[model samples]
Target: MVHNCVFSFKLSSAREGIRSEKVRELIPDMLSSYTVNIAYHANNPDVGMALEKDAGRYKLFNSDVGLFITLAFKDKKYTENIIYNKLLSDKLDVNLGYVYENVVAQMLIAKGNNLFYYTMESKTSNHLYEIDFLTSVKDKICPLEVKSGNYRTHKSLDVFCNKFSNRICNKYVVHTKAYKWENGIYYIPVYMIPFL
Candidate 1:
């Protein structure tokens, strides 16, 4: 089996201060089922190529948009096992949930060509916010806001929703619990993504 996982982080924040809590939550499952692959944005093609050449042999996929990976698996059952383990683990964090949201978005992109994924960058005074994922399905752009805890109205999400209401079909806030579609947005838990 082959699994392609694309993890995205907001680049507006300082690289060092951006917490690894999200990556920490994802690493165990990714490492168990398939060899881990990672990709990031590169401003220079020559530098990106140099890094890839030094990064060793693996399945690498690149595009004008950004960097990404394609993971080849020796077994499929490990997928289920890793998921089950992640559910049982109690160390999960909110930052980790945001990372998982990107993983889920990439998984959806891998499943079909009709869908397009992008990240949103916005500014408010001196503060900047980058939404985890923006997906276009059936010509409608859906902005996804990731939360690790109980679902609630978020200020950033609200701001994005209000600002892009004309372009966005509905804003989605993904969490770790159940799914709900209230108002014009969808509140979906991580486990329901494969089905959605």
Candidate 2:
């Protein structure tokens, strides 16, 4: 079974090698077959179930974080000491924001939650506001903005709350910070998400 699964990916024409049109054509099958998941926009009035399913506008998440990590960094042998050590020691230069977001999706799903997120165009500038993950608790939408160790501010969360404060239950910033509540937002360590 393992060999067959590995062999299934034996084709040289993988994601990077394929034309985008062909990849777009395969999305429906990938979605329906549970090979990937689509997270809708939770800020919608229907709480992310927008009634009209738009796969094209959805965000795709890997089924599991571990698999994503392995596949993303498998350009070299795992047994190769240099590459493995850098990854293990956090010294490797890689943009892994997607992996962090994937784990959030997985954790939320494990807690009997369907994945949802929010995005909006900023009025003051050409920039956009994006809330990483949103969950419904007691009929109020809780907005979560994920940040790396070097994030400057939770600007997206602030803007999102300003627009939809009436419908909000909690504002959270998920980062490497310790747990605290200040300025009406909870700054929680990532491990505390299941309790959210």
Task: Name the runs in model 2 displaced over 4 angstroms.
Answer: 1-34, 43-54, 77-89
Q: Provide the TM-score for each candidate, comma-separated.
A: 0.49, 0.76
- Model 2, TM vs. native: 0.76
Candidate 1, pairs of clashing residues: 22-96
Residue-by-residue lDDT tens digits, candidate 1, 1-196? 1112433234225355534455445645764553433333211212123232212111212221112211222145334445435445844232455245445655554554222222234564654343545555555566666677656855667776776667666688878777777877789977665655
Candidate 2 per-residue C-alpha lDDT over 1-196 given as tens digits, one digit per residue, 9 for 90 to 100: 0001112232234444554455558767986786676576544723544453343445767776767777777776563567657765767787656766777777787787876666789988999687887887777879888775554488889898998889898889887668888889898877888999
What clash count goes with each model? 1, 0
Tell me the deviation in Å of residue 60 in model 1. Answer: 12
- Ten-residue region with minimum lDDT total, candidate 2: 1-10
TM-score for candidate 1, please give it.
Answer: 0.49
lDDT of model 2 at position 38 = 58
